[model samples]
Target: MRQWLKGLALFVAITCLVWVGVLWYWQATSRDMSPEDIALYLGLLPLVVFGLALLARWALRSAVASAVAKEAAAAQAPASGSPALPSAGQQERHAPFKLLASGLSCAAGHSAREVADALKEGAPRPAPDKALRDDEGLPVLCARIEPLDTAALQEAWDGVCAVAQADLQGAEAQPVAVDEAVQRALAALQAPLQQCLSQLAAWSERFAKPDADGPQAASAAVPAGLRVFTAWPTHWSPAERAVAQAWVKHCLKQDSADWLAPSQLRLMPSTQGGGVALWLEADRALRAAQREGLPEVVLLLSCQSDLSDARLGHLQREAALFTHTMPKAGVAAESAVALALADETWPELPDAAAAPVLLHRAAVIQRDKPIDAAGRVSAQVAEQVVQQAAAAAELPLAEVSALVSDADQHSPRGAELFSVLVSQLAQLDAAEDTLVAGTLWGRTGPTAPLMLVALAAHRAEMNQQPCLALSVDDSVARMALVLRPPAAAGAEPTKTAS
Candidate 1:
């Protein structure tokens, strides 16, 4: 404070003196009214301008530097008896979650084993009804599925949840608002949040979003793990948006948990699943539950379909209505996948299910460059995410068993994935047996994350090795997850004679 004030005072004094001197000289020169005086006065004007520029720069520099320093110091300091910051060497988190079991359902398969078989046999179906377009505006096939209206969503959810051991109860629901459930959940956690909320809000906007209704007392309805979340389209009409919000809540009643969604869920041309996965990992890191043995569970999902029932017939009209021409360059397909993940704490998983795969690491990063080239990862941020994951997992890039990737040649995500591979994993070739789940499963909408994670787990099981899952969202948000197969079991004890 003292230094800044001194700087400001010095700046003001010098500037005022210089301006006064210039005015006086100008008055004197004008009074003389001679040819030399005119030349001298003009010359003095240039000198005056230079003096002022130098003066301003010198004075402001100190003040600005002091201000910036103050802000940085404040940011680093614990505020009003806040928790002390973690030390630099504290790299490992206290609570490390394991994957105990997983459940998956997609067009490719209903179970992890089935998905693995389909990928092994290369049974991906062809794009139907001109789902995508080439750069030349010609038709480019994508892995499309049958219609994905409300009925399809319900049917797929029913089948997938059944396999996942999730039971839905209550009467059938109308397409009404479900915002109240979300609000109540947030309210329930508000007290714990008030303790460390300032810290948590840095990563999740959920805490930062205004609760204009102050807060109601904690509701017994909200559960700890369940996060009621959704990402509705911004261009949607009020009715359309309401249905989307309600869909998530209605779905939550099916599972009976708090709903949480990442901002990435709302609108993105590609990689919605990856984006949400990244946020989910971040939230996990911030959780107060640092219990090692409790483990963690994740449900990841994605879906994409034509804007409406008439999408196939009115492609041209749809293209004209939107400012961007994604309908021209990108494919419109329908897919929905559900994956249930758990860590070692839940060891009672069915023996017949695929062996549990460990999630070694997860990362979400915001890049300086926003993806404009349609699914390209020219941004350096994506490479850093992969490198960080490998380093954190203590796993070498060369040992990657398989890739659960979003960069398929037939899909929009294909543009930048090659760049990521060449830059990050020098050990693997781009043509290596990478599983592009979206391309193979018809580009499931928001459910893509769960589907890919499930696929990664399957790959880990089939090859008895680990795999890397990577995707770039809107070219800026880079999401990555690494899965490792459990270590081989030791020889069973010799049987003793009874």
Candidate 2:
């Protein structure tokens, strides 16, 4: 009987353990995922795995090919047929430098001073009906450039180019050692883009409805206006095609640029390919300035009239960002901002008209958790970025006389941003004034940070004191830059572009 009882007890213990395990699993699953979700995961898992595997295979193949090529080149170099190494002078390089001159084209104002003044005194208010309140009951507004069409873009491009050209004399004229590979890539990309536009122009004649003039005029028009319904039959959308066509045309217009040089460094706007092409030629000019041993200037400009269509102000379906009645996380405004950089190696010019703007220091850091995530923003990364910038500038936080940021004052993100800034302010030398660039220019898209840079440059020139520019990108990187008047002067300006 005792042996039978022991066996029963053993079975009961085993049964209890099994039940406990099942209960624990169910509890976990209650919070997230169900049988339906399981099926969805199962369907997606294969694609994800396949993508990862494909990437790995490509990387392995590339690495192996590179290794084999390097071996072959090494083996060939000792032979009689191998070419000799190029001389140092034949290989060109450039270091970072400060801005000698700056130009801005923004909807906020024609120049940085106007934009700064307007930003401080308060920009004109948007129509009450146009503003949307976000999930947190904060209003978001946007500033736009009047007429978001090609003419506006071309004009803005011309204005910025003129500024850069005037300040960076001979930058486009500066000789560059052509990189054959880069030239080939540029040509390859440009050729396809041109062809795409030409095709669109041709197809446009067939699909477009007759306008006031006649059907014949449609041939001159690009396929971008065929309407989404009409353009859907084609592989790509009209909107995408229009952006590409505009970019390619813009590139071809920059005749002053050395076409053979490598593509220049560009600060990409907020999204993947979000008009990064807009700065392609400008990148070339900036590179030329670097090659010519000239002071570096960064120009950040944007006009957002194009974004007024949704009038929702760059809204997304975040639960907390929208209310049943309104969306408040965005603003509409225009802005033009500029900055002059100062490299430690370059001497500051004496007898300067005003203390030239100098980039005292800058820092960027990735957040542990994205600020845009569902959780409360830690802002630790932002604080670290600022601290690093201050440390590099050798200035205390108290000395940050002014603050410029792309964040609007009305969103939850804005509230978190201000909270972070306030916590940091207690550690600063003097309380700094805040300028929400977006509040003045509306959400300027990628121009948000550019506007901040421009504003800092303006304040540095005006107060002859340091200004701090802070910004966060969709990539979860927080950046802080300190702009101040040039500490000293150097040599005469180099040959500049007309």
Candidate 3:
């Protein structure tokens, strides 16, 4: 229509110019022209002028109409609290929550291709990835309201979609108004919108800096392991991001107890199920911070100490032969052994009366330096043993240091006791049926410094070595040693076997 109007205007202007020129030329050159000529020229001049005037008027009217149309468009635009255009594209960006505030009046879903077609207030059918099922597998269609006035919302939404595409295409240079689009999309997703809003808000809060400011600014949720201040890096490299994401996902799948320091994560062979498996991830945020310009990389394994007596014992034994066995497999075995000890039931032992002889044997060792009596090791010794354990396993030195340090804090005495006990424990290699004993007696009572000596001999079971018996009592206190020999030929062994 505009093009036609422009062409008509051009034709009119050209015709007027030609008529004026011809009339002027006749006036100048045809001086002796008759009355008819004069009348004709005069008559034609006014008509040409009239045609020019009409064209000018037409142009003016066209401009006025364009101005009025623009004003009307401005007036029709939706404002605050206005019913949003129903298309998925009309909904706001960050402000979908605001549209959702009033609650969606209507939602719809068609096939996969038509998914965003005409959603209204109710939940739509399951998407391609999902299956909405009754007994049989079929597309389940649902809506929150009945007899939907679909035209207004869908048509409004179609306009919204066009606008949204334009906005997204130039997001960097020109952003679209987010309010209408957000409302439309969320209204389409009415059922989960509120829940999604809460989650999104929480995630934003988690990632956003308190001081940062911007439009379209985003703060994606940090992984769960990173929730703690010390656990996550403030500035992460791309590699670190990948590793952290993988580890966090794995941790989330397991029981909470499996979660631990990132350094402690290891590829150790499992004793329970089968081959090797990854342990918990250790923290590397500190390391990353220290190496500012370096690419962030996770230390694959970190050695850690087990404070439990049983765990420490297993670790010590494993360390002795780690090189011979699969280092990874051995470390895994030791770790599993430690975990088992932690999970073991602390069932009450028999009373001293029920097994006096066994109790006597136990008491001999128990009456040592109060620390040693509990089968605990010393901090100094544990540190050394942990170092040895880490070296044997070929772990990073820093990791070993951490393990030893942790051991010192958790069980300061276990290591020293282990050191003392291991040697004496070896001496009773010959005895089985008969018991053995070791003493560390002080004058007034059990002393800070104690010694363990073993004595045991076995005649049966093909000459099994002697069992260890130790005592650490005060010199002033009377020390008595007794051994219950094996019952002759299966007489129901009186004392519980050690």
Candidate 4:
């Protein structure tokens, strides 16, 4: 094609030169030419100029076509196999850095099996030289797996959390050191979650879509557990119950388990009273009646919200007389057999207020804004609202505090005697220590003699007899109460209530 175009250009150039020479010769003798011939030559000059321009264009085009062909041939000779991917030798050349990336990716996975396989048999590193450097200055291939897509990884981390919760309930795990074991397992499970979260963020950026704000928030939070609680005005409906169960199944590996069954859940009336409701729900009703008259109770409850020291005392006072058929157990116990039972026959008590919110110190809601993204809560809001509700129903702050302090020092078993002593000892600096001793009798400080006396008083009350030997040491601000079991009593009940 190039040769043909060059030939055409040469022919046209030659023809134009010949015509120009002939015109010059003719003009030399044109003094005798006719007017009509002059007119004809003028008209033909335009055609000649156009032919010359065309010939020049053709020549340039031919040269370019030849040069491009030669260059293409040279490039092809080098090889273009499989898009010119590096040969094994070329790949080996990059192995030092590439191998490092593979090693790092394997380490990120942290599975012994995966790391073992990678060490034994090499793995694929990502393509492109540019991705070889990341924050660590170490080669970082784009080998990261998107966390949202890594269902297996999420499942593993979530499984650990389920095991921890089960350990608390004494189902899947033995409760030897229940609280400590749970804390350890939870910490271990959350370590890998950082990687999972990083991957999820990457995925969010990759497939970002309009109107994905809600989903983005959900992904960002990455709730720790099965997300059992729900917000108010959005109580657990039939559909929601089903979804919750399904979530439990997926994240907790618990399917058709009685704990997750919807039928097992009861819709009892909401409890009122900062911890008072919990004691009532715990069957301290009979105890309450024995101490203080059943003071027009509004609700029978199994849960409490605020856990301040004051609230705890109020709960204890109410629980002193509360009565029920449900079996009782200590809140903190080591043996699974001695701990609260996990059966339908077992009585349900309100769970303690959750550990303080640790993610963000305080919540802020801008008044002018339609929504407060920073303060808005999904599952936790309900618990707090319930707690605040109970707080609102309580006595004034001063009364609540005094009552709580008194209750802590003395068990409900003998509230009258403890309250009297607390009132009498209010003037002493050792009052605080005494209260602390009564609240935590077995666990008292060495320097607090007054606290030791308070513990003895508690023990005396438990024995249910006059404690005449008891004496209060005015020098050290200490008081002691002593008692013996009733002579006629055959056997004391192993269970005791505060």
> What is the TM-score of each predicted model, taking all chains together?
0.52, 0.48, 0.15, 0.17
| Total residue pair clashes for candidate 2 | 46
**Residue 196 of model 3, lDDT score:** 22
Ranking by TM-score: 1, 2, 4, 3
Q: Judge candidate 4 against the unseen true structure and give its global Cα lDDT, from 0 to 1.
A: 0.27
Q: How does each model score on lDDT? A: 0.47, 0.47, 0.26, 0.27
Instruction: At residue 232, give the lDDT of candidate 3.
Output: 19
| Lowest-sum lDDT 10-residue window in model 3 | 334-343
Model 4: CA > 4 A from native: 1-157, 160-275, 284-435, 438-458, 461-498
Cα RMSDs of all predictions? 15.3, 20.9, 41.8, 37.3
- Give the per-residue lDDT of model 3 (tens digit) for 300-395: 111111222333234345442112232221111100000000000112123322211110111111222434233533333223433332232223
**What lDDT would candidate 3 get against the real structure?**
0.26
What local lDDT score does residue 281 receive in model 4, on the 0 to 100 scale?
41
Q: What is the C-alpha lDDT profile of model 1 across 1-498, one tens digit per residue? A: 997787667656655666677669768877655677555655565566556767888899999999999999888775656556554234333112354334434446655677667766777554433534433455544444332123433444333333223222324343322232122222222221222222222223222333446564243222123222233222233443333334443443333222333431221122223435434753463242333332233433333344333443343454421113453233443344433334334344343344456675476677776554434346377778787766655567787766777544543356567666666666665545576654456434344555566677767766777688876533346677777766521122211211
Rank candidates, lDDT, best first.
Answer: 1, 2, 4, 3
TM-score of 1: 0.52
As for TM-score, the candidate ahead, 3 or 4, is 4
Give per-residue lDDT, candidate 3, residue 89: 22
